[model samples]
Target: MKHIVPVKWLLARLYESDVVIVDCRFQLGKPESGREAYEESHIPGAVYLDLEKDLSAPVGEHGGRHPLPDAAELTVKLGKVGISNDTRVVAYDDQGGAMASRLWWLLKYLGHENVFVMDGGFTAWKNAGCPVSAEQKVLIPARFVATVQHNLLVEVDEVRESLGTGRYVLVDSREAPRYRGEAEPIDRVAGHIPGARNLFWAEGRQADGTWKSAEEQRERFADAGLSQDDEIVVYCGSGVTATPNVLALGEAGFTRVKLYAGSWSDWISWQDNPIAVGDEEARNDG
Candidate 1:
């Protein structure tokens, strides 16, 4: 199946027996806002997945602000949400795919290829005048067996070794200000990985919050000096927003891309890892 589905297409298949819609709306400051919004109204039959509760494990001194949930626990959660090996899952959020892509990536990492992000997300669905419902769905539980793809994830040590190696391209998918160390709203330390290059995750979206075309995405990656053969590793503040960049890279036809699951939050958890600030040019050559 496609990586992304348009609102119209999803509307047409809203009630299909094999489809599972997930509402992933969330705010960093207001963690409960997503569930509140989902309760008020959402796409019909869509289940809610909390970013903090459902999508991530409790944060500790390490592993960034958001850590991957245990595979067995995730399998249980998916089963409870009516997702099975054959289910076609669609996830969405108001913030483009920033929140939803995490679920999409997690599903793929669990070896579920039928998962997709709703292009343009809830905003587009609402604007299109599609029907919304407050009725909660009570789905019969289905067993979801997860076969983890371990190669899709990387650790801090691996990232450190890859720096300036020319064999790997370390990508920081946070905003410009955060990457340049001008301002840090979340993590303790400002700046990014020493040799990492900045590629804002939001660049994957258009002005209307819709994803850019594959052609445009290819151009964006080309402008960043990336080729199809680059061994790319992407990370964001807490490993959340980076998933969208991961999706974008895949859409652009890049074959080898992995997620730095701990991201900057986990990087700064230990003081020994060097952090860099200022313009991209001022940083160490990678």
Candidate 2:
């Protein structure tokens, strides 16, 4: 709950000048649908940020499918949307917090700590019968300064070096089928990085599409037997879905959580990286 706010909380601050609401609804392979949906209706005073265009950079050979946006460019985009350093940003999406959490993680990586993901997303808002508008507000651009947090990210080489070393716990946030190499619809190669544990990001949320409580998130991660002091690096197909798990880990009181920004896609780009099929087994050797 530290990084997520409920619908009622956002509704109360709907008109606050300092609180900026962002609509981050995105669907894979149907990128335009999100904007089209926003054009139809969205929370009043909300601006839309597209996942593939605004949130991610152009794909490269080795940087994964959705690379992290350039900080300077993203800062300009943020400023254009009236997000300054002190602005309290609330990001929402209908994808069960996955898309919204991406914006939240990006803001935190940019050294803006006041951002949060809206719990239950757009569905919860509409179900509550809150005010919706089709009007888009054009506001004066504000100044956004970016102070990048380098330690919050890990490179492919770093992940490779730490394999089987217990230096960090690499968490695969994809679904069980993807992790087990049973199905791979998006990426070129199947399976996950060797030594990585599967922790499907969706588990961070409840069956009702709402996020779990802090204690519940802790219990969800408890199966991993992780300690608060352990170094945790989370990743998914690209680097998007893993964000929810990163935020969830933080909510679970893990102090040293980080993201492997390139994720599985980037890891497989080299072709020389080791890949493991089937479930990663627990090691009994000391």
Candidate 3:
């Protein structure tokens, strides 16, 4: 049960006794908005995980906008929300797997193996004609153990070293415009990492806004010069959107992927850090 659960699977699991459904709907522009929508209406018995309050630490110049929360804090938060070792957790967000993938990554990082991302998120669920329940579900607290896997993440130095050696396939999950140094709406500088190939996470989504099948995802990875097994590192503006690619690659059967959690935004903000623009890219700094 390490893979993302399909819409049909989740619809049936809605009635499972120990299932934990978390609504992770969020907007990058207005962070508080996701919770409001959840409070208004959500999957019956679903609880909310706030991106800022529950999922991330406060933004700073050093850390990206939504830095990963402390493992201890997240364990407490998940427990307070009634998560436990045996819980079958299902998470979803509005942007297909955008925000939901974040929680998926977090849960995996914390060593929760059975967690699933609701394919297509809430929209897909509603489109499937599943019933929505607004009542907040009561929870009985249970112990959640978080054994953070340090290897799942990569720092900037690790990326820099992998560059000259060609030891890893660096990938930018941002759109081509942003990855091409053409249009950057959020961050200060508008370019991607040097030598990193483009694999926009949005491509992983279907026209209807749900993840494509695992076979389709595997093909996309192969098209990008990525095989089912490769030493690959993924990144987006920050660490958030990149998780979708992480999920996609994993779904595609690549188990060696790692995330540069402090991605472009974090890279550009540094004075002596490497910067690249246009089609030709790589490091200019020592």
User: Which ranges in model 2 have alpha carbons more than 4 Å from their true place?
Assistant: 282-286
Cα lDDT tens digits, model 1, 49-122, are 99989989998888999998888898899999999999999999998799999999999999999989999989
Quote the positional error of residue 73 for candidate 2 in Å.
0.4
Global Cα lDDT for candidate 1:
0.91
Off by over 4 Å in 1: 282-286
**TM-score order of candidates, best first?**
2, 1, 3
**What overall lDDT goes with each candidate model?**
0.91, 0.93, 0.85
**In order, how many clashes per candidate?**
0, 0, 1
RMSD of each: 1.5, 1.4, 2.8
Task: Give per-model TM-scores.
Answer: 0.97, 0.98, 0.94
Models sorted by lDDT, best on top: 2, 1, 3
What TM value does model 3 have?
A: 0.94
